[model samples]
Target: MNGDWLLRGRDGRLSVYQSSGDAVLCRVERAPGGPWDEPRKVGGEQRLLPVLAVGQGADRYAHLVAWRPTVQGEAGLVHSTHFRARLAALDWNPVGHPNKKGDRTGTPAVAVDAEGRAHVFVRNKGGGVSMLAQKEKGGWEPWQDIRGKGVQDGLAAVTGESGRVELYAAVPEGLLYWRQEEPGARPVLKESLKAPVRPGTLYALATSPASTTLYYTGTGGELWAWRPGGEPVALLPSAGHGPVAAVRCELDGHDCTLLAQRSASGRVAFAAYPTELESAGAWWTESGPQLTVDARVSLGTDEDGRVVAATLSPSTGTLLLTRRKDEPGLALEAWRAV
Candidate 1:
């Protein structure tokens, strides 16, 4: 449904609001895949930004992360939690809590592997990047510094078809990747790409399931793609002036498209490439009329191969949803009327 918004809490609480701003659904849980038992109010006077990720399963579970402010002027810390639909639970359990001093940590990006392990990537205020993982039997693992120093962007995780966990982070120097074959072992640096980087800047990265091609946008607004044996190919010709967000998904069962959003004017764009054209060395073609959208749009896909774009209205602070049409010309249909 377009315009309908879902808000999640740091403690793994979920509240679904109707298009008319009515609270229609709510739940709480200890973990995403869990037997949820507790329920409580999401206490806070200030607005909290909720980031959620669907786990790797046929019946996907939603994991949430958020940052809250403390009573003092200092910003509250980041927290991790999860929820699932089967149990109809909405309470969020804190996998990890923030430091008591409360110096302002940012929200975390979450991912769950095939084994149901949770991986969190967080950017500390001091410009350091750390990753935390939770094993099945073991509790929270010690936070590992992915980027020892410098600001990071475009952190993402995807469970490869081979069952290996792939993590990507874009730093000031370039893009960095890490992989782990099994638990209790360090994640090895699989690859790194040297490219122009900028601190406090955001870039989008996604790997094709079929080809494992890593795609990203530079600070200069140019789109680039990297494969195993091939050089990085520049997809977009002209550069723009703002951050880029992208999601990789199949289109019409034939084309693999990278749906990206430009910040300069809040326009949604698409870069469609034939999945069968993986080794053909074909260039990425861009197409879009640049629709007006809220600045905070999140890109995702549904089970039926439909692209879903969610954003919160800056003015009314309402959530909006839009879906890409299943037609042949790469059109988009706004399910939620702005």
Candidate 2:
């Protein structure tokens, strides 16, 4: 539930991740959706938390980052890559601990910049933030203390259309965040807004290169959207139980944002909105029958440019995916077992 569970690589193959037993398991496609290979324990004996897989660069290389418990509940984040083949077909490079003492950390979050360099952030043991950035050509830089106070984990990181990286975390004061003034520069705390936000439910939509709209679930599981200088817009009073899944796509010529959430009945409930124009109003739409299990939904664009929604079947721990119909709107095909 921490990292992105679904990603489509540049090579047209898809990968799905899950936290199975004592490891972070990954299953890659032989083709676009299935037939998928068996789940591989990519974290080795690391006792991983949920696996996070994201694609970066023109080649769309999939980077795997996960947290493993270390000394006295302190956690270390490990990094690895899947180049152009099956996941871990290349090498699993370990990024190890930020400090020799291995300070305790909240769940780590990552945002790959425009240049494809990953910027990693976490709520350090100090209740502040610390960051790890990748060098321009190779290697990772030292972990720098990006100070803050009363910050929570479930950090949300994303690169804006302007190529700047932004980080957000819930704090007692509302939301504490940082944004880079320009590309490749280290970000600093730029805004601590008076917004009510549920930590770990944040998902962002880059409306423009310089602007992004944040989507998250409220304390009562209602869906809300907000931007840096705008008031929070309530979209759905009931949007399931946890983190929302969102993606930006063009529909019927209009730029729209598509959202999916696990409904109260353990089914996938979704909706669409005019991107950045939430004042136009929106409506919640339920698709498919109620699922017996409460699993999270993840969205990704297919090789054909159709939005693909997937969830790990709780009963079988396998992937269940459905593709957007080739027509308009958010209509989707029936779920296909992978």
Residue 218: error of model 1 in Å? 2.5
TM-score of candidate 2 relative to the true fold: 0.90
| Residue range with the least summed lDDT across 10 consecutive positions in model 2 | 50-59
At residue 112, give the lDDT of candidate 2: 79
Off by over 4 Å in 1: 1-59, 70-82, 85-90, 95-102, 105-107, 124-128, 198-213, 227-230, 237-248, 252-255, 276-294
Q: Against the unseen true structure, what C-alpha lDDT does each candidate score? A: 0.49, 0.74
Q: Write the per-residue lDDT of candidate 1 for residues 1-338, one digit (tens) a residue.
A: 21112333334333332211211222333453233333223322334434333233222444444444445665532333334332434433444433334544654556566666767666665666666777678667776765534546445555555545666667678866677757434466667777875432343233554335555666676656656345766666323443344555766666565545444545444456654244444333333334345344456555455666655444454444566787865577753632
Poorest stretch of ten by lDDT in candidate 1: 17-26
lDDT of 2 by residue, 1-338 (tens): 55466877877987776767557677888987558788887635666654453435444765667776667856677776666547454344567664545655677777777788888887777788888888999999888888788887677777777767888788876777688877788888877777667777887657875698778777766778878866778887756667788888888888888888878777788788788888777777777656655577888887887888898765568577888888867788998777
Query: After best superposition, candidate 2 residue 6: deviation in angstroms?
Result: 1.2
List of clashing residue pairs for candidate 1 = 2-336, 11-92, 12-91, 12-92, 27-90, 28-89, 28-90, 28-91, 29-90, 29-91
Candidate 1 achieves a global lDDT of 0.49
- The numbered model that scores best in TM-score is 2
Which residue pairs show backbone clashes in model 2?
Answer: 161-209, 162-209
lDDT of 1 at 243: 38
Candidate 1 lDDT score at position 237? 34
